[model samples]
Target: MPVPKDNRPLRSPNEKGRYRRAWKESHGNLLLAFAGLIFLIGLAMIWASPPGTPEIDVDLGTVDSADQVVSLPPNVILIRVATSQLNSEGPIRIAVYDSPHTFGNPEQAIIKDSLVPIDGFVVWEIKLDFLPEQFAIAAYHDLDDNGELNRALFNAPVEPYGFSNNARSLVGPPTYEQTIMQRPTESTAIEIRVY
Candidate 1:
């Protein structure tokens, strides 16, 4: 007998398995090709991306030395700071403030600050660019090398510290006027004893 041309359900229970296997075999290659295309597109996007830029280093304190010349004043003061009873042989921090605003503020009077490392003795001969003016001195022995004076939890100084004219504070550090020391001549020697 000839096969019927009518669109009736021809897949029986036994033929359904063969039909599914044939369908998978035919679409397997297409599915693999689609996945390969997606992988190639991803690789192409990654290769076409721009390279990252290198990091740059910048110096904040850089200045043009050619245009600016540092000239010493005609009447510069040469002050010799001698320390006695320094508990430790570490760096000695000395600060000079010519005004009340810069008295306890080291950042404001940074130019007048000096850090001298004690080499078997405690004496530092520093030169000031300014002429004779009202100035105050605050010195401290940095025993911990932390660049600042270390203090206790109660705000008391843990390191040996002293002010000019041997000024001491009852509750806190000496004020601007109390620690003031005059420079009578071009050069003078001021001795401070660390407590």
Candidate 2:
């Protein structure tokens, strides 16, 4: 028996080595290109991930200043917030940043979902694994899905902004010093206004 001939042309009949040569030249680069594509895909997934938000019981009394203490022995922290009203769904994120680790950096791993509902006179307590001399607390509602605090094009706009100790209000994020609060190992309360 004779083998049948494949009549159809794999490449243009006129071209001698177009297809095979192209594949040979591109084969090595193809793997690198594919690897690069995979890396980019991984990066996209990480960037698109939802960042965990923290919920701290805001305990605030309209005293001259705000003072708080971390429950010692166990180093448990208590946050008492006193607010007149709540944003419909805004500035819902409150973060406590540990200083020296960088400002506005969240020290607690407690995310802001499936914990407590925003009721009147919100109170939250968290265990302090490591206490720092100072930290910054921020409460904000992520209205836009872009994440991070939203600002105007000129880097100027009035959005929901709050800091530890109810620091000075700004059209944008406040300076590092203003947001810093002394974290002593005692029950301390910082006054914050709901934006």
Candidate 1 global CA lDDT score? 0.62
Cα lDDT tens digits for candidate 2, 26-143: 8967887999989977865553333343344532433333555433334556554433334333324566666534555444522232112265334456555454576667665454
Given candidate 1, what's the lDDT at residue 33? Answer: 93
lDDT of 1 by residue, 1-195 (tens): 344589565666688799668869889778889999999778655533323433222221225568553433334443434444335556777777788888887777644454554432345445544533578878877777788888875586777677778787646787989988675555444466554
lDDT of the candidates, in the order given: 0.62, 0.52
- Alpha-carbon RMSD to native, per candidate: 24.8, 14.8
Looking at candidate 1, what is the lDDT of residue 11?
Answer: 64
Positional deviation of residue 58's Cα in model 1 after best superposition, in angstroms: 46
- lDDT of candidate model 2 versus the reference: 0.52
Q: After superposition, how far is residue 1 of candidate 2 from its true place, in Å?
A: 99
Clashing pairs in 1: none
lDDT of 2 at 180: 76
